[model samples]
Target: MTRAAIVGIGQTEFSKASGRSELQLAAEAVLAALDDAGLTAADVDGLITFTLDGSDEVGVTRCLGIPDLKYTSRIPQGGAASVASIFHAMSAVMAGVCDVVVVWRAMNERSQFRFGQPIARGNIPAGGGSSFMEWCLPFGAQSPASWEALTAQAYMHRYGATNEDFGLVSVLLRKHAATNPQAWFYGKPITLEDHQASRWIVAPSLRLLDCCQESDGGVAVVIAREDRARDLKQTPVTIHGAVTTLPFNHEIISDYYHGHDLAQLPMAQRVAARLKDLTGMSPPDTQVAMIYDNFTPQILMQLEAYGYCGHGEAKDYIRDGNLELDGSSPLSPNGGHIGEGYIHGMNLITEGVRQARGTAANQVANVKTVFLASGVAGAIIGAG
Candidate 1:
């Protein structure tokens, strides 16, 4: 059997508005990763990306002038599919179906359209909206914040968590981002008081600061067999334990009612176990984490689900400065989606590679292993 590794990673500057097409953004990132890996389009034989990425494989292939493709695929389910794209590439390369697969995600989210605005209600069955979304749309639970707020409220109530607890996460991530030149919020760190004073987007709990930015940019990674990666331009970040798991009766973002527990993400917990089982490594072995912080509450929940802390203990763990660059867990030193640009969690994926490479702007100390999670899917990247 073959092993997979990420030999290259690249990104465009995170911005509110990128005055370019999605295809252009995708091509630029792809080319950057190829150059970083000391390879070219001719070395790529497969491609994988998010279903939401506006640029398709054919267009990106044409832009790169690639001769042919042996494999191409897309994964859906929003942010959850972020790491799943890497998982797809790993499987493809490991199984000998293809070699040198490029995984990418690019979007003109802000300049073209805003995700914060309410989605207009329509017939909506053009492979567009999920059937699960239709149930909550009529009740004004259309946007991600609104849908997630229900569960956030429940989590807060159960754990005695307040908005201040959530604010702590926002504050810490912004602090990390402040020094990262590529972060959109770079040089703009916030105080806890600032988080408290920020306006509410779906209130009683969720604040504007708690929500992630709608960024317009692109990120891409080059995955090659581990042996080939060892001979590349940079340290090979071996892909260990890439897994995606869903618990019984999983619904996309609207995981709040009936049988679904409102306080925890069961899928994430299962994924945590899967990672440990696959790699025989646990949270204590990791030097840094690049968890998806699409929303602040989810960040806390992920910490608990991934065994970094006990259930309902994440806020306290964070308050002790465990998430700081010098702290124990050292999460998302590149600012995460909250402070970094949100390209469907692709930035976090690249950050994991950066940590292992010792090239992160806000470097974690002696990082040999980096943990990454894209909602339900996750992977462990290690310097080998």
Candidate 2:
């Protein structure tokens, strides 16, 4: 299969604005990507996105007034599919099925639809949010915070990660975001006390600061054959190797009793193994790490499972400043979801492209491989 590269990238301001609908946000990003790619929307033949994205393929195409002719698809597994959208696009492009593919995600979640809040028990809820919500919602598992608590509790029970260790993870990301101007929490650094004292949305796992923002925005990218990308306006971020894995018994989020460990995102290990094989690279050579940050502990779990550190050693490793921007191997120097705007994991996706293109605000020197991880544990890696 031929290699695919990101030729262009675009996004709207990350905020709680709902003046524009999801479709309009998506269209804005799409049009910007097309222009950046030196291609017209008429050149787009395929569309890709996550299952959670508000804009459908036809809806985005019609809104943009693009004369699309061929492919369209949505990757499932929630926010985990953010970078996977690019992987799917690469596969399609390599197979000669589509030429210029646009991957986009749009959500008016902050205004019309909010995400980081509790479901109304006395009111309507989304379709898939039934059983689990029913069981935990009344018990104050009212939000994502509560659901993650069960797993974090289990992880702490099994191993010995303390609140300090967990604090280190958020601290590192917040510090990283402090230097990133795009971060909403930019210039704000949190102490361990700051994290600990934050209001408890879910005790023992998530706090007010522990969760991601309720964001409403959109992002899109244009991808094409690697050979064709260098001829465009900017340097292209190549797809070195991208894989998607959903472990057995994986649900949307809840995995506490499913025979899965909270300190382990099995999918990260799977993706790491595949990445090792595909790129013929090792962990030490890894320059950056960008995993999903739905909750801080998830990153801790992923760091261990991906073997950045041994099992039960991630918390310690992070405490030593291993995951900071100028540390051993930086993870999400661009604020991640917790600090950066949450357009799903699209921010991470764009950060990966920026790193590969050497345009990142906190650009890592001598960078070759850019590991762009996503999921609600979706992990994907790309390069230029």
Candidate 3:
């Protein structure tokens, strides 16, 4: 199939929530992206969003004053479906299904609805405990932090790694966030000592500093056929490859028995290798990586999965300062989910675009490609 590329992107300021309706947030983000692409609402032929997304496709279209639409779809898997939003949009454009596709997400997850809190407040459904809901919450795994703790501890036991190793990640991201004006942690740099001293949310694995802050904001991207992208005003970023993998018997957080070996996220490893093969991209060829960091541990795991390091070697690799901006493999330039507002990895994707455009607050020199690791709706994007 012919390829699709991103020609423009847009995002609202990250915050707890602006009191704007979800529909309004969606329209604002979509219109901003279209404007950035030098296109109008009338130019968008398709729309894509999350299945869990509050705003329906028709609702957003009308709010944005879009006159017509030819295609629309939704992807599911919570935050894992984020990059997949782009994957679906781009695929449609490439297959002659739609010409101009808008990939967007808008939510008030923080201000109005707190996903991190227990769900019992709203009254539990009768289906009962076996739901992804029951899998963790019933067993003291109230939040992602507690869930990650299981895997983090297992990894440490297998590799003889320590809390200091995990602390290194927080130190690096906070440092980068300090330099990022738009990041929520702007001008805030936490040292390893600070990381060590932080409160433990789940113990041995996640700290108050290791988990991402809940954010209420929206983001959108404009995608078109690669051939048509050249006519646009901005530099075109091709969708080199896109893939999503569901780990066998995947639970919301840690399926310990199935994923007992912390170093073995075979699903991620397989997809990374496939994307590399499809794009002819080696780990060294990329200039930046926009990895999804719902938790600090996942960042380390992704690095190893992508062949950046051998299994159980992320501890040493991270300790050597390789993930620093000037170092070999810079992890997140926009503070990631830690320093930057967490939009379910959508912020990371935007940072990837900024790096490719040479406009990031902490821009790495000569960026040509970016590998984005999104944790929304079971989707991933590799664009450059």
Candidate 4:
């Protein structure tokens, strides 16, 4: 089988307002990634992005003046689409459908729109928006915070975890972001008290500090065949394993309807199993974990789901300082989505690449493997 690797990574500044159109942000990020790869627009033959992205391939192609494209695709499922984009790119490269594939995500989430806001029923196009929204919005579970809280209540009840326990996840991520120059919260570390004092977005589970930032930014990466990546500008991060698992009856972020325990992330478990089967590596084997942090509870749940700890033990695992830079599992040294800007989890992918290359802002020592998990999707990136 052919192999694929990430050759370049680029992103615009993380900000509350980028003061530019989403298209311009996309173009800039794509160009920056191509430049980082020592490749030109003409070198790109494939493009992939999220269905939620406002900038389409034609718009980005026109802006970059790419001669032509042989393959193009859009992945859905919100934040899960981040790693899934890599899965598609790797498949395309391995299958010889394209030579150089650029995956990008650009948005003015804070400036132009807000994902944290409640979705009006009338605003949702008939049969177009998420099916989960239909079951949630009517019951005052309108926003992401509300839905997460509703689902997280089960875990807190089952494991006797407190809000402060979840707050610790925010505190640690903020600490990491404090030292990370690219993070939005750089040099702004917060304490457990600060996390507790923040206004509750969802009482009992989520606080303002616990929620990830809705930032205006763009992130892009270039993927190529391993043989081609060897000649690229940066140390290529090989795609050892890329897998996305959407288990039956599972909803997107608020996966309550699944016939399993709400405290457990079935999709993440499936992804972990698939990754180990594909690459013979598990979460404990990796030096770094880039788990998505749309909310604090997610980190804890995924910590358990990814086999870092046993069931109901993630709170203790996190409290033991295992998520720190020098700990057993240094998590998202780039501050993750909590401290870093949330480019809908795309920034996490770039951070994974940096870790594999030993060039991250908060570089972990001897990082041979980096694991990226976005609830339903997960991938193992190995240093090349």
Candidate 5:
């Protein structure tokens, strides 16, 4: 099969308030990525983004002055659609539906509406509501934090994992972010003690530090046919594998209804298996991971689902220093969404590209393959 490569990556400065429209953020990222690839808007033929993105593709195309668009689409898994957006772009290029595809995600999550706030009944966007939300909303499981708290508590009870265990993941990622000028917490590395001392957000399981901050930002990447990418300005990061999974009956953030096991992430596990099957590479072959850290427990759950460790072994994995930059698998070397600004995990994609190109602020050594999982989907990008 013909391949696709991410040739350029661009992102706006992550902040609590961008002070700009989502459309402007999207356009800036798109133009910056094109510039990085040494290409112009005229070279693009496809546009892909999250279904919830405030910017429309038609509006973005006009902003970029792209002559025409052969493919433009959106996927609706909310924040979990991050990796899937790249997968869709690769599929489009491979199928010859488009030549140069740009995947972007822009949001004013903090400045405009906060995702952490409780939503009124029926407020969930189209195709976003389910029996799950209906059942939980009336009973105070309104915010995303509240909905996931049930699952997080279940996992904690099952694994004997404590709040301190979750806090360590937060501490470690903040350490990585401290050195990264682009991170929202760039100079604010925290200690395990700091994490433990933080106030609780959802009682015993989650603390203020465990939750990811809402940020206003945009991130965009340029994907091109592999052959043409080799002639571009930067070393092309090859898309080795990509997969999106909603195994059997899995819900977006609240999958308690049917996740095979509430303690596990079935969608992530399915995506992990598909990615390994497609690439013939597993976690051992992975040197860097940019897993989504929307919440601390989600990071632990995804690590286990990705086969980085056995069920309930993520605590041990972290204690063994495996998540550090000098550790076996340097998880979230760029601080992930927790310490880095959250742009719906789109920032992780660009960080993965930087790792593959040996240009990251917190570069991992000889990082041939970087693993990415946005909870519901995953993809592996390798240096070619």
Candidate 6:
């Protein structure tokens, strides 16, 4: 099969308030990505983004003056759509449906809307076609933090993991972010003591520091056939594999009712298995792991699910310094969503591209392969 490669990446500054419309952010990111690829709006024939994005294809085309578009798509599952958007773009480019595909996500999540607020108090509707939310909203699991806290409690009980263990994850990522000039938390390193002192968002499991930032920004990447990408301005990062899996009984962030172990993330396991099957590589084979960190406990769950460690062993794995810059896994050297701004998970994908290109701010040495995962979806990108 033909392969696709990510040739360019761009993002607006991570901020609490972009002071712009989501459409403007999308246009700026897309144009920046195009410029990075040595292409223009005319070269873009395909577009992909999250279904939750406020900007539509028509708005983007109008703003950028894109003359013609051959393919356009939107992925669902909220932040899980980040890597899945690449999957769609890669499939399109490989199958000859389109070339020069652009995948982007833009949001005024902090200034215009807040994802951390309770659904009952926010603009998000109760049902919103989510049966899980319908069941969760009435019982006080009304926000993403609340929904995730339920699963975090079960995982902690099963593994004897405490809030301190999770706080370590936050500390490490913040350390990385402190040196990352583009990160929202740049120059703002925090200690485990600081993390512990932070107020609890969900008692006994999640702290205020454990949660990712509700950032306002946009991120975009340009993809093309591998052969064409080699001729672009930047090093081509080949998409070796991209996969998304939805196991039975799985809900979005509230994945507790799966009739299985709450300590394990079944969707992440499936995504990792599929990625391994497709790429002949597991988490250990990659140089950097850009696993999603919407919340700190999710990082531990994914660390295990992605084969970085045994089930219920992520706390030990992290304690052993495996996530350090020179350690075995070297997770999220770009600071991840916990310390970096979160454009959903799109920022993570861009960091993966940068790692593959050997240009990341906190670049992991000799990084040949970068692994990206967002719960149900994953992809492996390698330097080409």
- Compare the candidates by lDDT and give the number of the best one: 4
TM-score between model 5 and native: 0.97
Candidate 6 residue runs with Cα over 4 Å from true position: 121-129
Residue 34 lDDT in model 5?
A: 94
- Per-residue CA lDDT of model 5 for 1-384, tens digit only, reads 789999999989999889999999999999999999988999999999987899998889989999999999998777888899889999999998888999999989999879788876845444643546767777877887877788899999999999999998999999999999999999999999999999988877889899988999999999999998999999999999888876666777778778367999878878887887899987557899888888899989988988989999999999999999999999777888889988998999999999999999999988899987898888999989
lDDT of candidate 2 over 1-384, digit per residue (tens): 578888989888788885888899999999888887888877788889877677787888788887855888878766777877877898899999887889999887788876877775722444432345666767666766677777777777677887667777777778878888887778997888998888877666677777778788888989888887778887777777777776766665676544656667676778778777877764445688777888887777777777788888887888787887778788988888888778888888888778777788888776777677764333334454
Per-residue CA lDDT of model 1 for 168-255, tens digit only, reads 9999999999999999999999999999999998987799999999999989999999989888999999998799976666766777
Query: What's the lDDT for candidate 6?
Result: 0.91
- For candidate 3, what is the lDDT? 0.77
Residue pairs with backbone atoms closer than 3 Å in model 2 (clashes): 80-375, 109-113, 238-383, 374-378, 375-378
What are the models' TM-scores?
0.97, 0.92, 0.92, 0.98, 0.97, 0.97
- Highest TM-score model number: 4
Candidate 4 TM-score to native: 0.98
Clashing pairs in 4: none
Clashes of each: 0, 5, 12, 0, 0, 0
After superposing all C-alphas onto the true structure, candidate 2 shows an RMSD in angstroms of 2.5
Considering summed lDDT, which 10 consecutive residues are worst modelled in model 6?
Answer: 120-129
Residues 269-306, candidate 4: write the lDDT tens digits.
99999999999999789999999999999999999999
Model 4 ranges off by over 4 Å: 122-129
- Give per-model CA RMSD: 1.3, 2.5, 2.7, 1.2, 1.3, 1.5
State how far residue 366 of model 6 sits from its true place (Å). Answer: 0.7
The local distance difference test score of each candidate is 0.88, 0.77, 0.77, 0.91, 0.88, 0.91
Greater TM-score among 1 and 4 belongs to 4
User: Of the pair 4 and 5, which is ahead by lDDT?
Assistant: 4
